[model samples]
Target: MPISGFPEWLPPQRMIEQFVLDKIRSTFELYGFAPLETRAVEPVETLLSKGETSKEIYLLRRLQEESATSDDQLGLHFDLTVPFARFVVENNGKLQFPFRRYQIQKVWRGERPQEGRYREFLQADIDVVNRDTLPFHFDTEMPLVIGDVFRSLPIPQAIIQVNNRKVCEGFYRGLGLPDTAQVLRTVDKLDKIGPDKVAAALVETAGATDAQAAACLKLAEISASDGSFVDRVRALGVTDPLLDEGLSELLQVVETAAEHAPGLVVAELKIARGLDYYTGTVYETQLRGYERFGSVCSGGRYETLASVGNTRFPGVGISIGVSRLLGILFGQNALTVSRSVPTCVVVAVPSEDKRSGCDRIATALRRRGIPTEVAPTAAKFGKQIQFADRRGIPYVWFPGSPDTVKDIRSGEQVEASAADWTPPAADLQPVVSAG
Candidate 1:
């Protein structure tokens, strides 16, 4: 039996995964983001400092090694952001300012297996960081880059719900809430538990009064496709300088997205990303009808998290939950590959004497970039054709007078030459298509 949360895909499914990842990487590179990768294990204290996700971090150890060594203190990184922050700090002198990089890697979590949550999942993340200050324009560019990626992939349409942490922090402060972070965490549960339960938790857990909880619920309910969210928050009758700053920034985000990637972004007031690291714009992405599976991609802005020697590195980033997206897509049969094997044609060996000829044919086809396989045995023509059919190899080559090839699917045979024959472009590689 397979382990519950650790997914292992079949050959065809792995091909689909590669196709999606390639699209994401190309899109990131098109936007001038350099590729990067960090180590899987990080210091225990480094992982714990992220504030959230501490409980879900997986500690690393050797099965045969005895406990009590310093090595036991290291843990597998739960997300890409923490290790990246440490990377920036350690390589501060080498990296150029306004660094932009894209990372695609696997992350481990000790959380329970659920629809979208997993113990081992792959994340494709892109981030932009700069010394002291990161321009807000990068915030706008992030979604645009992701929009292109999602559009390029063969999956359901993704809706990117955006919110500003400043909006939540400022509004909480305006409501006289002492612990804005705690309240934001509680409010982040609004989706799992309804508004009423969230309000009750705010009062009982976060020390909010009934009136404050009600006001918080109202604010969470405010969402808009344009700048209307700004006016709606103002109508809430709460006034604070931080609130003004947040509203203005959020409005710019919505307006800029509308001008460029229309209908892709919306101002969602309740996207309190639960992580304490985000201090400005936060993002969560969901497939249109798969909201129940949770956000497949999420990230945000961390203004003061990457700082060393009084120089602060403010940055914004987003991570695509590659495993979660593929899990749901494969589960629902939303997509499929053309074949399980990559062989475009299988060379038939009439007898042991002609095996070398079959090998030469395969090698020639392979040299021309065609995926070809020689028959494992010098079997009968019918048996060799059956072998190719079983593996979904579309064509079978016979080295005979004029070198004939047969399309197994249609039973069509035609004279062909291995040195010059080329299959249709669609048949050159396995095709992945949405169901």
Candidate 2:
């Protein structure tokens, strides 16, 4: 019916959505973060290295004749992190350590589309990596930056749930479950497949007995504040070294983050990312009352996920589902821009004979960084004003008037200077309608 997985929008919607993404990228860049993008496809083998993540990849194929060799070497990227690791390795020598970069691009997943989960969607990601070790503080602060973007948009309160991979691994190993990675992938699907299916899969593939599966479920079910969750993980009688270390690290991060943005990060012990790649922290985000919309932001820490020669890169980061978030905002009427583009003032063209005069006035305003557009048609003055009104451009400029501009919104034409004309702050730029 509607291109099932790929979604597009009309002018106003696309405009508002782009406004959100622009702010995200801009905020990241403001922090001196560079931007980078990788090819959409990576070697199939690399994509499959993470079990359930591989399941989501939309594979690529040869278009030529059957004579083509079976390279079995390509697939669409499901996320930005893996390809980024490869990118750093491929250009290690030329790159700077503690590389800070942001990427805004499309990712593909061959999954059913319902609400926020689209088969193909755009993501805005930011990460900071180092040659060998990335500071743990990034785990706490990076989410705050992400939260800032959401706050700037002034949407509903968003909560960030964080957990540790080592904690999950240790807990699973304590339960006598072999292949903790496999178990993780299954548990990660708990919200989607429900406990019964996840338990069945775990028992079937993980040598987990019914009771063991229940125990794993109990672990998955155990999520709380830093102190409480750590206590629950300890009570499981799973004596593992990684368990204690992960617990301590998670506590430090949660405490550190709380110091900056109180009550923002939760120690959600169930956030087992299931990918062998994530070595430390993991994150999930949701709107306060719209948790069912799925995670609007997600990512984590990876240790040694990228290696080249004798060097490896370890880092932490997160991504916002820009398109998904905007779509949700639109559906709920939570955000919207009045027009697709900002037009500070539109110069009315009385007649084609007066076209050059209109161009001069529009140019004068535009040169000063004011977004100005000239009336395209030679029509009645009322018609010209309507054009600006329909586009939601606030003020209309008249070339021959002695510095007079009309507030299309208020219908008050005033004597204002083309050089110093200022619209009220709120009316200067169109706001995103909340719906």
Q: What are the candidates' C-alpha RMSDs?
A: 1.5, 2.4
Worst 10 residues of 2 by lDDT: 64-73
Predicted candidate 1 versus true structure: per-residue lDDT over 271-387, tens digit per residue? 989777999999999998888898898999999778998999899999999999999888889989888899999988888898888899998999999999998988778999899
For model 1 the TM-score comes to 0.97
Off by over 4 Å in 2: 30-32, 50-56, 59-67, 401-403
User: Highest TM-score, which number?
Assistant: 1
lDDT for 345 (candidate 1): 94
Predicted candidate 2 versus true structure: per-residue lDDT over 311-378, tens digit per residue: 77988889898778877777787776766558878888878998998888777777777888888898
Model 2, residue 154: distance off in Å is 2.1
Error of 2 at 382 (Å): 1.7
